[model samples]
Target: MGTQERKALEKQLRRSQILDAARMLLFSSGIDSVSISGISSKAELGVGTIYFYFKNKDEIFAALQEEGLALLYSKICKFIEKEPAPEKQLAGIAEAYYRVSEENKDYFDIINYFLSSPRIFFEPGLKYQIDMSGHKILKIIQNTIATGIETGVFKEAQPGRFSIMFWGTLHGLLHFKKLEHTILENENHRDLYEYSVNKLIDAIRCQ
Candidate 1:
């Protein structure tokens, strides 16, 4: 192996170690309890070594949250790849969203933590950088909406705006479950998810 390649690979490995440690600490101890020393201890590295990779706990958590978003985006992309029709794609994306949440509840909580925080909404530059991963997922939704409009499966509307509505509704439903509030108490949980997604589709469909 080339000397420079080896160094780069080693650096990446160290960063991954720090992130893994931080993720464990954040989940086990809550984000407010995470600290440089805590991560260093968890990672079995010197505090100074962790500093070399991340500036603070927030930075480390932000990186971890980005990974979670990337997971969701990848799932959406995979579902979209298998479905050509826009309506079907939308349904697939909704199912994929819930499927990821069901499988990675902790990761989903990390995402919601970053998203619902006022800091991201108040700070434009920080919001942009942190939301980039989410924007990728949103772009997929926007494209599906645009395609639906073109195919006359959906009513004429701004794709971006509708994308927000679609995503926000799904997030709200997921949030209810996270909060332990049984809005869909009588119905099977997955049934409620399908019901909500179908409702969104019906609302957007050309009548």
Candidate 2:
């Protein structure tokens, strides 16, 4: 409520503005084009002001990862909950993962930055937080497998191995789906995702 607190809050808001603008550009285009001055212009702040909040481009990107991932994690949680069963929950989680990438490709690009282009992304905190926070998605996978096994919906299966395999398979499918231009017109894209999940679902089902 004091004048000093109000001033500090305003400063924080302006810095957040810069990060949001930078994230937009990074997702729309790519990180190669996002210069300090460029982000300042988009944010309607001064380059000096951006530097005041962030030491360099690396810091800006890290903050973007933090903020954007929070949005994405919320999306996954919201979508996954809409499903009614453990099997549908697994399918929903996989679908929600793709939805996040399509809806907020910026955050997706930030995650893929470390995977695809390793040069600019080298922050330890970013990696640690992402993996830790992403554990929820993994937990969903584990729970789905456990449920399937328990109810004989999925019987005599390697839940741990299924979790890893399912995630790895979907991640690769999505990565390539996003990367290639020609893959755009493929009619089976949607089916492929379903088929991928169903393959594992079938593997675990009582047979």
Candidate 3:
């Protein structure tokens, strides 16, 4: 590459470093405590460099959250690739969600902030991500429902209403299973996610 290209690439690398540092800090601590100075120090960038990339901490957070969510979606796409059939895809999606939750608790913590927290909601210039998290998994369920209609898998997928019901079912059940164990001792948060999904599939499966 040319000298200018090299310089541009180096600048981009620095920006990514800042972003990565911010995410790590937020995940390690809570978002409420992260500061531009801390992130810049962590990234080895000048404080002014941070401003060049992001207006403020909130903007940095918006970028980090969006990037992490895209990673989740990309991972989901990989899980979908493994399942050649719709039924299997639904199961894989359930499994994928559970595995990702276990592996990236920090990411899910951030996800929760985006989902239910007032911080993301009330903060100006900070865009909260959409509730397409379940959509990342429920695409499989929705597709299965649609394909079922064609090949007699389900009676019919009420497109107007079923997506919400189906996705809401997944979301509600997952959240309950995720938190139930913490509230009570010796309660194992097992494959209730997959089981709940299977039950829904069973209910909707066409005879």
Say which candidate scores most in lDDT. 1
lDDT of 1 at 193: 75
Clashes of 3: 2
Model 1 clashing residue pairs (backbone):
none
Per-residue lDDT tens digits of candidate 3, residues 12-86? 888789888987888787777899999988898889989998888877777656665666677767887986666
Tens digit per residue, CA lDDT, model 2, 1-207: 999999999998998798789887887777778899889889998889988999987778877766555765677677768976767777777887788778878777666665456364646766676567556666668877898778767777777777878877877788767535575565467677788778877777777
lDDT tens readout by residue for model 1, 1-207:
999999999999999999988877877887778889999999999999999987777678778878889989989999999999899999999988898888987778778877766654224555566678789999999999999999999999899999999999898887767434454566666777788899999988998
Clashes of 2: 1
Error in Å for residue 71 of model 1: 1.1
Clashing pairs in 3: 148-153, 153-206
In model 1, the runs with Cα more than 4 Å from the true position are 1-10, 119-125, 178-183
TM-score of each: 0.87, 0.74, 0.74
Top candidate when judged by TM-score against the true structure? 1
Question: What is the Cα-based TM-score of model 2?
Answer: 0.74
CA shift of 133, model 2, Å: 2.4
Better of 1 and 3 by lDDT: 1
Candidates ranked by lDDT: 1, 2, 3
Give stretches of model 3 more than 4 Å off: 1-12, 27-29, 118-144, 169-187
